[model samples]
Target: MSKFNRPDARAAVSSPVKTKSRASGRTYEGAPGHARDAKSELFLLAVANMVSEDTFYERAKDRDDRFTSLIHKLAVEDADWTARLLGWLRNGAHMRSASLVGAAEYVKARLNAAGTRERRTHEAGEGPGAAAFGGDSLAYRTTTNRRVIDSVLQRADEPGEMLAYWTSKYGRNIPKPVKRGVADAVGRLYTERNLLKYDTDSKGFRFGDVVDLVHPVAGSHSEAWREWQGELFRYALDRRHNRGTVPNPDLLPMLAYNLAFLESAGENPECLLDTDALKRAGLTWENALSLAGSKVDKKALWEAMIPSMGYMALLRNLRNFDQAGVSDEVAEQVAARLADPEQVEKSRQFPFRFLAAYNAAPSLRWSWALEKALNASLSNVPTLPGRTLILVDRSGSMFGAISQRSGLNRADSAAIFGTALAIRAASADLVEFGTSHRPVRFSAGSSVLSTLKEFTSMGGTNTAEAVRANYRRHDRVVIVTDEQAWSGYHGADPLGQVPANVPVYTWNLAGHQYGHGPSGESQRHTFGGLTDAAFRMIPLLEVGQNATWPF
Candidate 1:
């Protein structure tokens, strides 16, 4: 019934049918509808040229390190070298209809088969000899050992981690004494550099690798961030400083940390950051105190810095200081001192080390409390303003995974968040249509949060359903998709089903900007890089604020 057979793809166009239907001007079963949607097909053809995976990779390979990392992750997680190469070898091999999930599954099956074969070969003693090479037996194994070492070294960031990785990966290749000595040497080197604090003489450093999965996470920058935080905490509220009249100037870094986080969240507090503009604005503690008329002028800067009571209190807690231990009077004094905006430098909210601050701020954590608030306050999020329902792709591929910080989950989160915003923007009640047509499958209407967590990172993407769901309503339908449209051809969409007045905005979320303006005479905003799904939320936020629905 479709244009092509399974596992094969047609070039997405057809020669005009020779015959015409007597009942209609043209009909190849659905040719009349298909002819009507041909223009959309033609537009997509040009778009496919501009932003396909191949095009994106070619553009990003050398130019962006982030993309390189993404490719590297792809290589590691779901590689299918044999099948992909076979696809290339065969003329009509690849299909956009095939989900990457299938490819991943194919690769997994091949790996299992290969493992089984290798074991069988070992049992039969038929695949080469114990040594892979006949001429140089010992050298061949030694070369394999060296390659394993190289692989471990390249991935491990720390000497300890490097040593551990080596021991784990090549324990049998390396003699026990050699492994122990290597780990000890690595730890000693790290300690000398102040990168590590423990004594190397400590035992149990030689870890046997049974696939060190958690080690990578433990040894990454995330780990360093944790250790650095603990050290900095001690340095900040180190109570011994109370012995002197002067607070250690070293504490400035602590405030800087908090300020940096707030800034990253788009909350820029002007006080702490010492920008040239601030200096020119007469925002200095001296000038601010002059305005407030305070005797705390001599210690003006110190007094003002102390009043960020929330900031200071959090820091005190992080430093292991018990609130109950601090006398009520001293605590009250500190709180009162920082209470006055004049004393606290209302401008001091500047972000200095925002990432560290955000990481450390347990108050802003994603917990049950925050989730409840998110559900309540952000409920009634508007749709793309005109659609009865907006179906979002929650498949793992939908996530924009940049730095693991912009996990494609945001695409899901953005959809939910955007839904809430849409509800807020709309004056009418949101008549919910709870049905999600997964490519090749469909499901009932569900909560955005559930979709966020359970959506497969792999699946056929059903862009047609996503775009065409709201044809009957006056509501606008918007689809921000990578435009690759991985779901197999569903024929020309039923666009004619919708009222002509209904607006449909297909944001071909390729990794480049095609510019924005209404194409169907409705506003369209196309971006280049967001196809990765990292900043999907950003567009929703921007749109919500301006209601930049091109129509």
Candidate 2:
């Protein structure tokens, strides 16, 4: 008989245990359909937010490729869906992992299995672009060029056509991250066996062809270089020499080989001395600042590189400019350069950095520098027209790290976002909720770090009671939570306990598979993501309008 029909030895030895029945009137029943639906919601969350390995997708059985299956159907059936999925890969570094690339491959395999006319082909160097359908079909501005290159490298069947796209279609002015990825791919040509296994050396030759087309030499060029490996460097050197500028600054290091070659051949070093390529080499922000003091103009170097640095880099090296012979006036100019409100909106880590700085260094000598940057970054927060109640969940589960490598926890991230919103809103009341509800006092113009110290993790989640304690004459309620509550607080659903007229909106900071969120499958009053984009939904949600796609 089958295992399901047989009585196992372990079953005979074990005592029977009773399981608690779920409360009545709830939609979730732990049924197959329920779990399937939950997985579907998780797949959407993974696409809209960042993908996590511990979530529903990882727990799925080996045969169940529901998520990948859906991704293929969406790619073939709708171009807009394809654009959104591709666009989302640009959300963060976590989104650009190998798992996402594997998903793209699965989509291609499914298309092939169906024997459809839209089969992916590498003919004439056009397999990956086929996946995108066409250049005009999607908006290039929505994503970073580096993400596009990473996606292309992951999906392309051949390197030659991919190289052609970079030269002919993608353009030479690529971003640093994208250039790093491409350079790594090119550098691995001799070492990586699978990169260039084709019969003809046409791809490398084509790349060299493009280089000569762009920057022709007077004398005959040597054919000493092999396929693809040295051609990219050659192209970069030629281009840098032709334009008197380094196209991609990160690729600037490859010019070292050219410098040696030119030196041995009795060429002048003045050609590269005029270019700013050396200043952009892979180096720490502090090291780069120090090096730029002698070789390049300090003001120009600071202006070009400071905006690209992450919040942590900017925070950690606040004193570097001063020590690097940069005048106080120039340092202030660099600080103001990064403090632009428009640029702050594009950064994902400003809130976290601002909070970390606020908490770790309340009396830091350069605290004012970070505060000015933080205020400028938060200048875009729309002022609410009425009283707003902001509830921050500080449960034990939230103390777990958001990423495996990150020291920051979800609670702190929530606090950063919460404190910013509370401080920015026109009229607001801020409270921390865990096992019990309590009001938090954050004085006007007070430091966010000091305010964060006032909040701590309680043992259990009492969301309903917490909401009731703080729901005093407020127009709308915004709860920042993981959405996993214990039993109902005082025997009532959190939403049901609230005043009927007051709409409850849950901002799901953690992308849980099955949320305790009231809206359930119909996301009429729910949103997800770890950024300020969620706040934009509030204005539209108040008028009974659907939330726009935040990413």
Candidate 3:
């Protein structure tokens, strides 16, 4: 039997008997299986740190047949374990975890009683009367709103029932995005269940319900915008019920309205949008061209549409319009904008945005634009006052997809963040570690995309050697990885070699419960997420201040 009472925890180090067997150096239950036990510990470490609940369950189920019972026991009696699991599910969305609904349902099913759930300590925040929903405060409402919506969606079977669940559980705290998601989900469900006939009469699908659900705050930027959107949704539903055809571009949400109008106009909707109507509908020039149907003057429209898109949005969507009427002049203009260092400095997008673009673009034609974006992204990276060293793990496990849908692996994500940090730091050295440590160099005028393409992924996970070899006099050390390092030559203890005065922060791409590297939970820390906000915490930690979750 294992020494620890908890079935899910790591195996204990001590042997059941102090005496060693003659046949083998160590014996357990009269067997020579200590090596196997060591392997199992490594496996457990990997399972514990999976990105989220769904991933944890997937890996556990694949690794052990008895995992169902083990998870049930953990859910029912292990409060700390349950909270940690829930935290992974709740917060992992920004990091690209599977559905929150699925995670909640899994937890609820294994609870002591049916439909019974409780909030955990870290999520509830420490204070008197910090209830799960936290009454009417906006901050508290946002904290629990996403969770409540996912839970309600999982529980309710019908749109009407979903509306009732929303009314009772969410009350006034319902988020606008939650409303849109629910409407779309329920619409699909209704079609599958032959319940679409009941939609017209329901308030949830019509104007009144949409308004009530998304009553935007009085002075917010989108208050008037949301009101106009509500009008369009109402009009569409009303016209659908009455078998009407015309779709007004000024009142409708761009995509759906554009499609409907195109259909009504024999797939040849008018080339021009009513300027007043577009303004009233909060439409962008890009919105007007989204349904241009491939027949419009691509160059003239592109030039005229110059003022319609934001710099970031323009950069993001440039490749999408490559086949359209993009003239050489237009491409040149865009390239010039990209090369402006000032434009790069002003862009709010994180380094990963540029990396993603660099990864997806097809040819040298887009290289200049991508290079500029990379430079701009690096400008946003905060400068560290002291020396910093960054280690990015390129082990095999880091090649797993960041999200099932993103098509981006954890290795690229690590490289993107790691390289950006290195470029931005006033004084820093960057390296990649897999079988062993190696310095990652960027050639002069090299873009993040090009650097990543040329960077080779090594096979083994000699993480300890990487850190130990790179441990110079750096004041701060940042290691980016999935944290699945195997037993290295130096015994998997990279953090142990660092001097006491230096701070080591591990950014866990996969939300695994255990770290192959060390984290002190204080000055030395580990954070999990896809956002650049995690970088903001380093300066705070350097100044000896406690940093709260960036969300």
Candidate 4:
């Protein structure tokens, strides 16, 4: 009398048209266990649940509290079996939308049914670290249960394709929380589906706090703030110890904070100045900032203060350093100087080293260096096909570089070069595949300009598919996704499409778009509709011409 009623409308319609026979060698029951394929998966989950539950102690005499609690937690967190069961009931698995909400019901019911345990109360006579159980058989039971759970959680960190395959195969029906946890995963993926752009977004700005440096380092303090911050810290430390000497020309920002301070410190003796900074020492940003710590300089709250190393100096004690040699006396002197309301206001507010040093440094070399470093890194980033079917993630996260074309986002421009290298001189077959589909070939001497002619970048990420398609063609498989897959390339679910021993050369795609893919962690982010993989990283300017992370 259930929905399985025989004379249903669907059956009536199908009466005229005979359905395909569930065939000979491949029966519905013949599906492989653990495979993303549905029939097989449902059978497997049911069997597993039945077996695990049977093995678990449930007899009245064997009713162990610790074992019961552990089993309860497993029933709560182990939603995988439930998700797969529900998924098998609906989709056969491998359906694109299956990852979203397929396996929700059965898992929810089981979790709710899991019983609770009594809370423990520590005995007054017991020591701080004493066990709640009186060192009896209960103690071992509790300890073992905790240890087992820890081990399970730890191993889940790199769940990778298996979890995604299983979840994606049946994730949709799994309810919201499990759905999110499975999708979110414990990873750094660049898929940008979560980000919502604000209307007429404000130009890049600092975070709400001034000291947190959420904003871009620009303007007033832009030129020499970093140097000033350093000069200040060192000078303060030195002055407290009574050694107010500037060490090197590199550390010369201390002399540059003010023409007056420079003259007073005898920095460049030829220059004349009217200031008492020399005798008292031109306080470094290090000197002033160490006094106030991480707090904002209240008196000059309106102004943007730059520490000696720009903002780096102010972020002290945030990093661990061995400064045991320095005396408490130095800290006390800095505190006393910082106590004066006027000096506190002046020192923290208008620390001069940054602007002065920036003005003095060689023609925007720092800016130039950053740009060049990125450019230089990408310069030798070998072309995709030339290397192998390095499935580069061309998702939403890739949108920015394609649109903005700046910073480390120039990889967009490098795509053409990849084809050129592979098709032109490579000894192997140069096959090109994007997103989750097939490969488009470009023969050597073919048009590099339009190699991406048929490449319409869209759709969700499919790392597994790209790898499987080219599994046999080459020695290595280069994956270029942002690794933001809630679900991944469909093969047979847990099979994960990727061939073992075939090292996937993961090249993370980053861009201006925030969440289309793994945003920054290269090989871990992605972008675009997943179509037209929108962006790329290109640091046109950097000091080191030859450097890149190990693939």
Each model's total of backbone clashes = 43, 1, 6, 94
Expressed as tens digits, the lDDT of each residue in 447-513 for candidate 3 is 5676676456876666678888998988778998766565555453556577655677877666443
What would the per-residue lDDT of candidate 1 be over residues 316-364, giving only the tens digit for each residue?
3321222124344444454343333343232222111121222243332
Q: Could you tell me which residue pairs clash in candidate 2?
A: 358-449
Q: What is the lDDT of residue 351 in candidate 3?
A: 55
The deviation in Å at residue 76 for candidate 1 is 39
Q: Candidate 2 — worst ten consecutive residues by lDDT sum?
A: 11-20
What candidate 3 gets wrong by more than 4 Å, as runs, is: 1-233, 239-242, 245-317, 320-325, 332-350, 362-380, 443-450, 490-492, 521-523
Task: List ranges where model 1 is wrong by over 4 Å.
Answer: 1-387, 405-410, 422-458, 487-489, 493-500, 506-551
| Weakest lDDT window of 10 consecutive positions for candidate 4 | 190-199
Off by over 4 Å in 4: 1-387, 400-472, 484-501, 505-551
Residue 498 lDDT, candidate 1, scale 0-100:
44
- Expressed as tens digits, the lDDT of each residue in 1-551 for candidate 4 is 56555421121101100112221122111212111122222222221121112111122222222223333343344444433333332222122112222222233333344211112333334333325433332222333322221222111122222233334545523333333333222212211110101101241211111112111122224446445444433443343344656444444433444434444334433222112332123444333334334443322211112211222232232112112222334333322333344442233221112222222332232223222222232233333333344343444333333221112221233244344335534443434343555555676556433454534454544445555566664544434433333233432421234433232333322211112111122112111111111212211111112222111
Give the per-residue lDDT digits (tens) of candidate 2, residues 466-519. 887788878778788776665566566665566655656676665544455445
Specify the poorest-scoring 10-residue window by lDDT in model 3.
14-23
Q: Estimate each model's TM-score.
A: 0.30, 0.59, 0.58, 0.26
User: Ranking by lDDT, best first?
Assistant: 3, 2, 1, 4
Winner by TM-score = 2
